[model samples]
Target: MHDPAAPDPNDRDYPALMAPGARDLDALDARLVDCRACPRLVEWREEVGRVRRAAFRDETYWARPVPGFGPADAPLAVIGLAPAAHGGNRTGRLFTGDPTSDFLFAALHAAGLAALPHSRSRDDGQRLYGTRLVSPVHCVPPDNRPSPAERDNCRPWMARELDLLGPALRAAVVLGGFGWQALMPVLTAAGYAVPRPRPVFGHGAHTRIEGPDGPLDLIGCYHPSPRNTSTKRLTPAMATEVFRHAARLAGAGR
Candidate 1:
């Protein structure tokens, strides 16, 4: 588990930090209506909306915020970095309707970590059976890099989501170094201990977490972002192996 004394994840005063963000709230919806917190993302999305207009003008771009996806409650929590600006930023579902999702869900399917392999978009109607995708930053961060402030603004909601699914959260797959760093603090706060052996984040790093309710295992992987797999930093077969362990921790498969 991580200590509360660890440096605050975000730079804001704790209470003034932004509210919870589960992709299913009225207040969150309103604040996100015109959020200028990150100027870069706002500019990019607006540019996308403008240049990509024509037939796409009237279509709701989900430009506001992309919330967490997957079963609200599930056996595993897979955390990624911020939503890719053009990817989830356009679709409103994390890890959905993108190239990254194609590779990711395929591995999860083959490994039996997910119920299905196709995640075209939120309305594609595909659903996860026992797995969920929760990003530390609920919305897309510009350049795929969330400032410390934006990440901090979003942690409370991540914590809130963990509270909702923690009981069933037998395992977690943190994709990429940033996502892995984001999870450490909350895991510690929940009485989950970072492994003494210092489980390093990699394609298949594994550690144990002692939660308030019980113990859960932690796994790390390179983010399924095309930036990684396309560069060979992460491979589909390797990703499958990581999920295989996560599934086993959840008692889902052999």
Candidate 2:
């Protein structure tokens, strides 16, 4: 049972409790790492940290909320659904130490965005140039699915991140339908004029949303999960092309 004195995750103002004075990404991230708002997520993350996956049994698990990776003032952002259970949840960095990262970072490197072709650990010497990676949900969910309430509970973090990134963020490549849907509202709330009826999600789909400073380009791409790649629904070449397009839109391309 949750302590009666503990803050309620369901409360609409729950985010305030996490970081009331956070005026920058670093402060926000520090607060995010300490969040224990959702009991289910908190329990699951810690359990995974303790119960050791066979391949990673010798390694210590980060087992906490994963934060966005890359420079604070990046021009382009790659938005994903959530952290992979054994990937980001273990490494404490988005898209690290998993097959999904293997596919995605290789593509990012091909597009001149990432310094390394693979993301395996927090200290992997990997770097992103003018690009940042973020997600709607920071924690890994059971079966890779976060409930609606959990999504909502985590929305504020994304919103705050976007708010801080607004000055430099010019374009975004959203991976999968879930990220596309989740980001639309956040964009709208961030002062972007998302189209009425909203744009549909599809691979290579592109739209320009007018923001207070200028237009922010949105591009859709298939998630780089093994399932999609194995089925040929998304290929390395396809993912690379999407990042290249987003880079050009954000003026970050080589």
Candidate 3:
């Protein structure tokens, strides 16, 4: 099992695969492709790729790490669950070209947070103004839901994203009950304590705490999945209100 003179067979040369002159997003995409840190995730992602390949060969699924949804220098971060089978995994943009994205983008537009009203593709005439979206899990799971272990395994990437944004970030809006539950630790680790008022995680709850770089505010909404909205668990208005708070935190709200 141990050979001192030979290069290890399992060792991968990560630098070789990186895109030439790639700085942030390109490098991030490359790193996401070979992510094997989580054994089970890697296995599952591979399986999805095998079967879904025929379903979306021309659509061009990400088939790798789903990159963050906004600017590298954004001040607001939106955290959510993994890619949907036909959403992010298919279109390569977080919440882009999907049913939920239409509702989410409409709200962002109404809140004066995003530059575009319709988000159909990465190069579409839509963009987040001072915001970004990063999921707890980067890959598309079989179901929309991720296992607890899977959620925990992906926390480091979220933390790393926060770290990357550093001083530019002032707040994060967690989308979904599960999203809020998963983000508590990351916020705490970043020195963002509960606000004096102890902001609740409802449609319009806004909380601000001092982070190492600057103030870190937060808003929460249940995810905009069809099931959530169709079943009246998360209404479009509720999600819009949360985004409005995020806009205020980012200094772009009405």
Candidate 4:
């Protein structure tokens, strides 16, 4: 059983130095749950846990900040905007226990990034290969939206994750404009040197940012939210293609 309450050896403060190097991602992840930087996010995440949706009423909610999932040496990273209020906030894993995860993980499995096609819960035997899933905002925000201030407040954690994942990270797949926007500064701060004008976000968009570890391709894909997927704005084929792009960029076989 994956006990979320287990004390981790990797719990530590964010180092002031932002140079590229191998870092203890596990420690960083352990420290993430203790964060209370954004009061509104903290309050809302807990409330949602206390009063869960009827479907998940019998389950315990992981109201604390969610951490990234995958190996520290993963060559690819997928960044989402935030945790779904009822999804990640309920299951304690990014994109888990939600329709969006079904869409996203299906694509990832097709692209050979995930061991399974579905992400139902943290202990559901799901696994990743050469890829990690992270979000700029760890907490579940109200209406699935986190204010700009909240995003900024959470920047350090994102920066730290990127820095820790820096050594092997070769590319990233960003879902939605919000993720693209949020990742720019963190990438730059982590020594990725994002372009001066910033790359525009669009479906199938691809850009390369220079990093200390190596050049990383930033591939943009529309989020697989209910609204986008239901409307066919982002179909499985389209999502799969984007994940394939990320794999190719990371030199992962299809």
Candidate 5:
């Protein structure tokens, strides 16, 4: 069923696959939009776009990979699991147009990292002062779960993101266990030495790893999913506390 003459979207060589002269943030985003490495993710994202969710019937879904949000040189970063089907997949921005985003922005605002307390669309004018948000997998996976192979396949993108962020990246707040697990290796590959026993993820877990730039502080926070929030697994205060600590570590006082 595969066409031999066509270019493979899963091509492993990043530099060769990217457009000529595509070196900046906008160019990197364009390259991300063209990724179709995972067959299942590609089909599901496109199908979700075509069918459209009931509430978003009048709106067009992004349907493609969602790139990291905020400036490339931000001092702190928040890493999430993956794009939500009706959230990032709909707004083309991480944590936008969803209840999870509402909770997240509120916490970030309280931590003094965000200018606003909500994000509805990409053009909402909400801005992050010293933070960025990215995901381990860029695509909206089926059933909100990406296969192990899929996550590994997307590592190159994450690696490039970490590289672009450069030495300015001082602290990272990992949301939930998935983000924690996904980021450990990325950090290790980026020349950071992970702990010997490996750090466990908890609501307010914290660890320090040596990064290419300098000592990178890693903080953990439970994801603000509806299930977690409704059940009180992840409270607003708890999430805000983790970010506040991260801000302090990054020397970006709130």
Candidate 6:
């Protein structure tokens, strides 16, 4: 039953809604999945789901915000720009069912972070060890570009997720410049002391931010997008080394 007079949850302030919570990661994830704070994103994601791509016309799309994936106490975090419109936005899991996942997971497996070399679907028995995959924006934006407003609207979810991860999250591998820029502020908000000028984003770039518990290492890596990989801007060896470096920094083993 629908209540016509009820205030729409989508219209509520998201950051405020998440502020008073003392819940665990599961609770946070539950709330995150139902968010429709951005009208443009809400309309776009749903529209894509309804129309769908030719190959997936018969399949159901997740259509909602995608949640972070991995164990609650993962020592390493892998941050990306956002869910792919036809990938995570359709598969219900970040970095699943796309060329990006194919390239990234294979690298992760080689670095001893993931159990499998591919992440095709949510229930495919794929697993990550001592690592979690998250993105700055949960909803897939049009043309794979999210507006600054949309990015800000989505910040609270990532902030809360990182807060819940807490001291256990020792290191992060940020893929691409967009994610690198987006994550800096989130790290600062999570109580890490970011540098005055802010560190620049470059492949193989590394910095350490002092957190309440200890120093957290940040490593930059080229996004494993089809464009980058196909052009050889980022090679398999380069990607694997970045993950391996982050794993070592986080003290995570296979």
Say which candidate scores most in lDDT: 6
Across residues 156-215, which tens digit of lDDT does each residue of candidate 6 receive?
888888888888989999999999989988878777899999999999999999999899
- Top-TM-score structure, candidate number: 6
| Poorest lDDT segment (10 consecutive residues) of candidate 5 | 12-21
Global local distance difference test of model 5 = 0.85
Please state the error at residue 144 of candidate 2 in Å: 0.4
Query: Residues 1-254, candidate 2, lDDT per residue (tens digit)?
Result: 54678565544456657544568889889778767667788778888889979999998999888999988989999999988878999998999999999999999999999999999999989999999898998888888888888887788888888878876889999999999989988888778899899999999999999998788999999999999999989999999999999999898744
CA RMSD, predictions in order: 6.7, 2.7, 5.2, 4.7, 3.1, 1.9
Steric clash count of candidate 1: 6
lDDT of each: 0.71, 0.88, 0.70, 0.84, 0.85, 0.89
Greater lDDT among 1 and 4 belongs to 4
| lDDT, residue 45, model 1 | 64
Clash count for each candidate, listed in order shown = 6, 0, 0, 1, 0, 0
Off by over 4 Å in 3: 1-26, 53-57, 194-200
TM-score of 4: 0.90
Cα lDDT over the full model 1: 0.71
Question: Per-residue alpha-carbon lDDT of model 1 for 97-141, expressed as tens digits?
Answer: 678988988988888866668677677766676887887875666
Output the lDDT of residue 114, model 4: 93
Mind giving the per-residue lDDT tens digits that candidate 3 earns over 1-254?
Answer: 43556333223322223322245654565455555545555566666655675657665556565767778888888888887666777677788867788878887887777787767887787777888888878777766767887676667667667777778888788887777778777777767765544455675566667777777887777788888888988876777778877777676533
How many pairs of residues in model 5 come into backbone collision? 0
Name every residue pair that clashes in candidate 2.
Answer: none
Better of 4 and 5 by lDDT: 5
Candidate 4, residues 24-91, lDDT tens digits: the string is: 87777766776666778878999999998998899999998898999888889999988998888888
